[model samples]
Target: MSWQAIAKKDLQDSIRSRTLWATIGIFLALILLLSWLFTDGSGEGTFIAAAGFTFLIGVLFFIPMAGLLLSVKSIVRERNTGTINLLLSLPHTRGEMIVGKFVGRSVVMVVTVLAGFLPALLYIFVQVDEAGFTQLLTFLFALSVFGVMWVGIGIGLSALVNSETQATITGVVMFAVLILWPLIFEQAGIELPSFAQRFWLFVIFADLFFLPGRIADGDFTFPSVVEFDEVLLEELNDVAISVGPHLQMWFVVVLVAFWIILPIGIGYYRFSTTDL
Candidate 1:
């Protein structure tokens, strides 16, 4: 109940913040602009083109940025300004405070994601066939989860650090590690050890941006982005086979769960043990 109260307050604060509206405005503008560019005089392939474009630009970049922007400061700001002490002075425990902040900020991030993708969803429903509509829904669901994943990471970092600058820098570095490092390694033909390769595979699988292509290709293979050498592909396949049981849909869910929960759990521990 205390967490609920805290969550309500965070949601209200987000609603009042200009940053929220500004993000929504910019997201909508991007979605609309992409939709316009993808649309022809006739509506052929409009939805597909727009949706793919959105997933590439919107999901890959904008959603992560927004989630981090809204949440990376959630706990540290309160602590730095001595407001966390004020909050704890109420009926709230540290656990409730963290849960409430996560829930509230997660809601803001999810809502922003929906607002960003709604135009594409509408375009798909209006101009595309039923199959495309189904794909659009699936894409939206994946994007929403991806957005929440970043929010959890941001909240965790917020709670983990002592200051906004620390949180911001850590958030950026973490993002780059999870996103950029894998990309650079793959592009440069650099080979990681088996375990590291699997971790990167897990990251790409969790992002699920390739879901549409997977569906279209009718190839349900994990890490479907690989177009590398046959030997490397065979090696990766061997690794996947070694971890076969863990590569199931359930394992994917578990991986995602860890991404969202592990950081928050660690952050809560740190927050609880550290003095305000």
Candidate 2:
């Protein structure tokens, strides 16, 4: 079959599955419920921030789940069912098959994100009058990049692992890294003298790895209420030392390039060499 045909079939199969749609539904419901509970009737500062935070949390959960569920079986299921051999026996190249699967799964992820988030955008515009529309758009754009990176990581793991169980576990661990790292950093009190400098450097390197420049930049903001004065300057200095003005854009670009290129290259390499 042609590559287009393969891609189309994969897309069709994904759409027919309930997993993506159900996940999107859950995300939307959670966002709406949180907004209702936390947002004031007038929808002002705290409410808007709450809405933004809620959506951010939802995206974090949804992206990895979507990536893992959509991609974990792309190749392994075929092998389990003895279809991988038949597909390899065809005239199609391994590269085309791998690309087709990635494109298909990535499309599913993009569609699900839009489905879950677009209505939230509309609601914020109509109901919550506090946040600017541009802010929501900017946040969503950053989130889409985050989702895409997770999807790439999931596909890469799926390609490398031989068993479905192993692939599922790998995907879950990767998902945990994507979701839990920030929380861990927050709880560890990176502002402490011993941890401050190292933490800032680690944060920059993570931003370079994750391609989320806005998140890294936002991390530099001082808390609204500070209890300790002595460590504040030192902490801010460490953050400043971690990411310089000139390097921010370059770091984001390089990270994004690597995020896009490395996974597909590695996945294709693994798929090409593996015995089908």
Which candidate tops lDDT? 1
lDDT of 2 by residue, 1-276 (tens): 556666787899878888777877887787666556555556665324755566655655665577678777787777788877877687778777777777777777777777777776666656665666556666566556656666676677777788889888877886776556656766987544322322232232334333333454665322211212333765877643333432333345445556656866787788789886
Over 4 Å off in model 2, which ranges? 1-3, 46-48, 181-246
Give Cα distance to truth, residue 235, candidate 2, Å.
16
The TM-score, computed over Cα atoms with residue i paired to residue i, of candidate 2 is 0.73
* Pairs that clash in candidate 2: none
lDDT of each: 0.74, 0.63
> What lDDT score goes with residue 93 in model 1?
93
- Deviation of model 1 at 150, angstroms: 0.3
lDDT of model 1 at position 157: 90
